[model samples]
Target: MIVLDYPYVSRFLTDSVLELGQAVLDTPQARRLAGDAPLHYIDEIEFSARLALGGKVYTNSENGLGHVLRCRCNEDLARQIDICKDKALFRESVAALHPDYRFRRVPFEDLAGLDAPDVDYPFIIKPTRGFFSLGVHVVNTPADWPAAVRAIEAERAALNAEYPEAVVSGGEFIIEQSIDGEEYAIDVYFDAEGNPVITNILHHTFLSADDVSDRLYYTSARIIETWLLPFTDYLRDVARECGFRDFVSHIEVRVTETGDIIPIEANPLRLAGWCVADITALAWGFNPYECYFKELRPDWDAILTENQGMATAMVIGDLPSSLDRTRIRDVDYEGFQSLFANILELRKIDYHQYPVFAFAFVSLPETELPALKQTVSQDFTRFVVTE
Candidate 1:
């Protein structure tokens, strides 16, 4: 059975699917498929959207393939998955569990409610269905709230102009009390039988100027057995309580000064980008891409045997000056990749166009983290960005 996986975005899936098929046609592998019959088109997004919008349904058809395996599903599940971007429903579900998780909804017309009392300054303001950090802002005080609100308003106006029909369906913005602490992302996968499996845990290191706080990068590993493993039960309970079953999820949490692990947000899908896959492989000897392809090899099990003796970190370089006007070609990226001698695995380059950030995963002896970071800062210039 041919499974045509399209980009996750519903609007771009058609073009992305056609482009993927065309790329396949240009490859040498396509010649080998010349004798095969017509390719069976199985569009995941279309199928999902049909179930979501058209009130259609689907069964899992197989076990161990996905958490949704062999299940009866409806439009509600699909709509919830699609419309509640960034697992907003999960956050709302968990919020109901606590009395102190109070949040004030700020409307586009009147954003003054965001300045309510007991509501701490420097809190996070984000669209209810936002992705990435698109329209998110951290307002430090009452003085900062107006500017943040105006910024979001300007962004919404721009989006409305570009896609007039696609109005912002969720009119409210969420003003959440920020959890001050070190930020970490945990990637969890559930088996077909409904077991909470910890795939990887990544400590996101923010790389930005003192003036800019939103830009961030991450590195991950399977060896997060120190403080993470002990909290797996808590995370699992949170996931199950939120109605998340067989799927990949990225959970971000903060370990506060009081030693409480507060849930920040959750994304109910594969963690975007390659840095995650690179770090997971470097530390555990198996890449999650393999799991995505349903390979299910014995090496997947080897990750469980991996110990938490080493510390792995990902260093992201500043955007190259020449990237704005030029396209990078024939990049001899080996110089950057070769710097880490202890790197067990290397994944593909993952970066967005504008920021031009690049990630590399390096494994260091747990005791040598400080010196390693210093060495990286000293030696990072060798990876040149060329036009």
Candidate 2:
């Protein structure tokens, strides 16, 4: 029941868990138990060894020390680490055990084999272990492949030079056959028994036109679904195959021209960034943060049984100019806050720290798509960040 919190997303998770009435251990105490806390109240080795030997489950042990501890407690933690570390291996193992389940791995170099004559242009390339869209590229044509490869190589080289210890050795990037369909994301939570109990779906829209190339983009709107019959079966099969019994998964899927469902990629972790939490609250009327904390909460039957008229949009603010910086300080925060009061649910004001990244969520009674576009364009100018 101990929870370690960090950043807004972690705070949201911790708060949600607490709201569910779960007794969570504080970070300091948890660290102390794990033998990393600065306090001298406990013997580090004895405490951690006892905790592991006593069958206390530790979460988020992906760090260096965590890896070492897991290795030491191999008898208890080996299955979890092996299942979590290598997804392709897990898929293969599952497919072997369950012949009915279909699993395929198209290597980074084998994408051209899947290409059909009608398989349109603009495919995406990505690394198997990539996150947050890093090492992702879109190839518009066969001619673009070499240049894209060169760019990726250059970036990798730079990263290696700067932080050689941080770079993974001998990593390969996968070139996926792009599915030219609308993008949607599903956030699924599995129980200890490996059942996909709670699921949420969101429609993701890319901010930059270039970002839509082949992979790596954010969603503009989300629709959470509690009872998803069609998708739940496939998701459960995947979860069981992967040996992921208790964790959140982010699944990317696309609807093809023929209305077939094609799964693009899956992340065996929480949704990156803030949109998942935001959309869950706005669209589902439940905070995922809160739900995640509730121990053995009843599985949702069918909350978002169908897609509602509600829509979500993200505004990617442009970089401010020197002139705008001079005037940004003069703007009235209270006035601008009131001006855009009706349309805004979340406003991230510090764009400079992150650089050219700000997002807003809007919910309207009617789907005034054109009016929504205009509102964002006009309102963005009001909060110019001046230096």
Scored by lDDT, the top model is 1
For model 1, residues 1-387, the per-residue Cα lDDT tens digits are 112121111212223224334212111222232224333343445444433343212111111112222132453343334422433455667764445765665666677444543577667777665444546677777777678877777777533321111112236677787776777777665454435566567666543221222223334334364555555776766655666554555567777788667786765445433224345655666544344324243243445456445676665543533354244443446776666667544433333332334455576766666565455554333454546
Backbone collision tally, model 2: 12
Q: Name the regions of candidate 1 deviating beyond 4 angstroms.
A: 1-73, 79-88, 112-118, 154-172, 192-194, 207-223, 272-275, 287-308, 318-354, 371-387
User: What TM-score, over all chains together, does every model reach?
Assistant: 0.64, 0.63
Summarize candidate 2's per-residue lDDT along 1-387 as a digit string, tens digits: 222322123334444444544333334534443343322233435445544653233232122223224336434344544443344454454554344334344454444444522224566765554434545677788777677766666655433321122122115554445666667777666767778755356665553545542212222223334225656776777766666665655666676677556666655445434333455665555665444434244244444344355555444443432233423454344444443334445454444332233444555543565565455444345556456
- Candidate 1 TM-score, C-alpha based: 0.64
lDDT of the candidates, in the order given: 0.48, 0.47
Instruction: In model 2, state the lDDT of residue 340.
Output: 38
